[model samples]
Target: MRQGLIRLHCGVIEIENVSKRRGRVTVLDGVSFVARPGRVTGFIGPNGAGKSSTLRILLGLDHAQEGRALVDGSPFTALRRPLTCVGAVLDGSGAHRSRTGRAHLRWVAASNGLSRRRVEEVIELAGLESAAGKHVRGYSLGMGRRLGLAAALLGDPGVLVLDEPFNGLDAGGVRWVRDLVRTRARAGGTVLLSSHLMSELAEIVDDVVVISGGRIAARGTLDDVTGGHGSLEDAYFALTSS
Candidate 1:
């Protein structure tokens, strides 16, 4: 399918026939999808359906056994400064327990030659101002998620990849994340977010890609993919239960 490459304001991702394996078991089998600029593309599927594996390949954390994953027309490792092209939050618990939230951001900023002013801006943007000076060890799961999101934004990359960002959020936190993602899209960023829950995705995603049995079972805008289906939940059920 031409390797799926196309120029986007947030850069481009071309994934084609990407498959992966762990020992004798196949985790991903001929999976391909595109995340365009200015939209929240929700990657949803049943657990063990290869959603996480696809994301891992896209983020360059793991290599595919077959096919390819490319960013902006180039392999991820080939980018001179990768973070400048994409920001990712694949894990929410990578922060140091002893460091205050602001301190953690400061170090990350310095590594990228960014200023502390930028750090404070994102901290406030993520609604972490009240918790900025506190150690991450004390932050609740929802709070930690906010901090992780702030870290991802510090790069101001045009592309963002968030894995299960709403997993532990409360109602308020969930709403906050929804707005944050939408705002990024409006600003011309491409957002690829993964979630196991279809109900939550129905509220935030512009398009949905359903993965199942280590492959893409359905993909399109919510309405295009769902068609006459009662709901995203119903469409999901039909695809996986077949």
Candidate 2:
């Protein structure tokens, strides 16, 4: 496994007063938070609390009706060779079912002008070598998640925006993700992990942002936000209940 040089250009993510609406439903209302470089920031919220919507806006997959999401002070869409700057895994698989894992990654690498060597490197990093030749449709949910993670690392990105990255993983896989996120942050990369599992977030995140009803309920370092609540899970329940 080749540990690449630390890229110094990774930037902080700033989401300011962003609001979004889907038809008549307001999915996000004044949602704001920051994922600083060299830290794992946890974005926690219940289902329908707009976590996914907020991530979509940040990735430039969807536009907000108000406010803005910026990466290193610029919109994601404006960046040249965006993948080299930020890597994202918004959902499951992110690949066609008929394609083998290797083929799926090869296409992404080709599109980004990344070398086959880089793809192989990420395959090893993601522990997907054994299953690399299998079609995605035959993969278990855990395998698919690993494949998505492999794709995300293909760019050796400075910033990682992963939504529910731990989903479908067994104990070993979960530990792998936890260590990987920590390693990335320690190397000066920014990581924003959105998940509903408070226990998992507590184990990895340096900062926590809690959302409820499309609004920011709390934001700060884990200790600051937990604030005598005993645990992140408790703090989250208390904050969202209010």
Candidate 3:
């Protein structure tokens, strides 16, 4: 984890009063959350609760009509090398199916001026070395996910924003992601993960931010958010069902 050794000057993610309107539909209304360095912050919400929208705005892929999304006190677009500052895996395969996994990673590395050695390192880190030479079309969902993660690690970024990363993995893959996330946080890197798997999130997340109806329903440390509830799942149902 050479990238994990890189010092994060300001790795905290602060989303303040972020609101978005899409064709008269308010996707996010006054949403706010904070993810600190060396912690795994779980972002959870129901479908259409604006989780994806918030991430997009934070990454500078989409604009927010109101409020601000800051990474280490500055917007993502302001960074000199965005990839090095933050690595993200959104909700899909970020590579072309026709291309080999290695080819896809090589192109991404070239785009970011990353060395071929770095790409190879990430491939091994992501456990894609065995299948990297195969075309993406033949790769399983878990393999594709590993490839996506390998690309994200190309820059050895300080911040990781992953959405539903455990969607299509076997038990081993799940454990791999869990260990990887924990390792990153322990190394003083910030991690913001969004997933519907309450059980898994409960196990690994140190803090959580729950969004409901385009607004933040609750935000705090795992114990704080869970309160007196028997489990995180119970608390989630209690908050979102209301």
Candidate 4:
């Protein structure tokens, strides 16, 4: 529950005609989609289909050979107070194993000028209350994920970019992430989630953008994309199997 208050900084994610190449191997080819406020856009594709590549480009972690990825109409690297504008959870917790969960969060908060109170708030929200004092080195995969999510929310950001967010989670953790992302969208925030978990993605996503072979396969509302299939999973196979 987000207290029924809309986040004022809700942002739009626009990835337009983005293409990337690594040593003559195309990673993405003319991939384009938009994740607007109050919507959870699922970016679903098979392994090596460029889901991570596109997100990395959107986060300014890699260069796109052509086109552009924009957050709130500006490139991610060009944004002021970047973390405040977008909170991302990519790969893993991203916390150093030697540091306690709280230490890692506090460090990030301090660097971003975020208050310690905010860090604690996110820790609570992420259900890492008891684990906060434990070193990340000992945390389980689910715990590390919670820590990553907690760090992402420390800024109370309006835009969230998550890649395989459901990985390494139990049923309860899955529900936790599902509810959290839904709550954020309901609060007028924008979310772009990249995952190959068709069933899970179908539950919380409002829009669907399917990519394959380093290119876009389909894009539309959930119902629109799954209309002719038995379910999102069936549609996913139908769309990407070619």
Q: Which residue runs does candidate 1 get wrong by more than 4 Å?
A: 1-8
Residue pairs whose backbone atoms clash in candidate 3: none
Poorest stretch of ten by lDDT in candidate 2: 1-10
Q: What is the lDDT of residue 216 in candidate 2?
A: 98
> Looking at candidate 1, what is the lDDT of residue 102?
94
lDDT digits (tens) for residues 1-242 of candidate 1: 21112214446666789989999999998998888887889988888898878888887789888999877667776865565668788769468999999999898878878898999999988889999999999999988888888988887877888999898889998999889889877777788998888888887888889999898998899898788788988988888777
**Per-residue lDDT over 1-242 for candidate 4, one digit per residue giving the tens place of the 0 to 100 score:** 55323354448899999999999899999998999989999999998999999999999999999999998678999976676778999999999999999999999999889999998899899989999999999999999999999988888888999999999998999999999999989888899999998989988999999999999999999999999997999999999998
Of candidate 3, the 10-residue stretch with the lowest lDDT total is 1-10
The residue-level lDDT of candidate 4 at 163 comes to 93
Residues 1-242, model 3: lDDT tens digits = 45445546758999999999989999999999999999999998787778888999999988999999999889999987777878899875599989999999999888878899998999899888889999999999988888888888888888999988898888989999999999989989999999766988999999999988898999999999999888899888888889
Report, for all candidates in order, the number of backbone clashes.
0, 0, 0, 0
What's the distance in Å from true for residue 38, model 2?
0.6
TM-score of 1: 0.92
Model 3, which residues run further than 4 Å from truth?
1-6
lDDT (Cα, tens digit) per residue for candidate 2, span 140-221: 9999999998998888888999999989999999999999999989988899999998989998999999999999999999
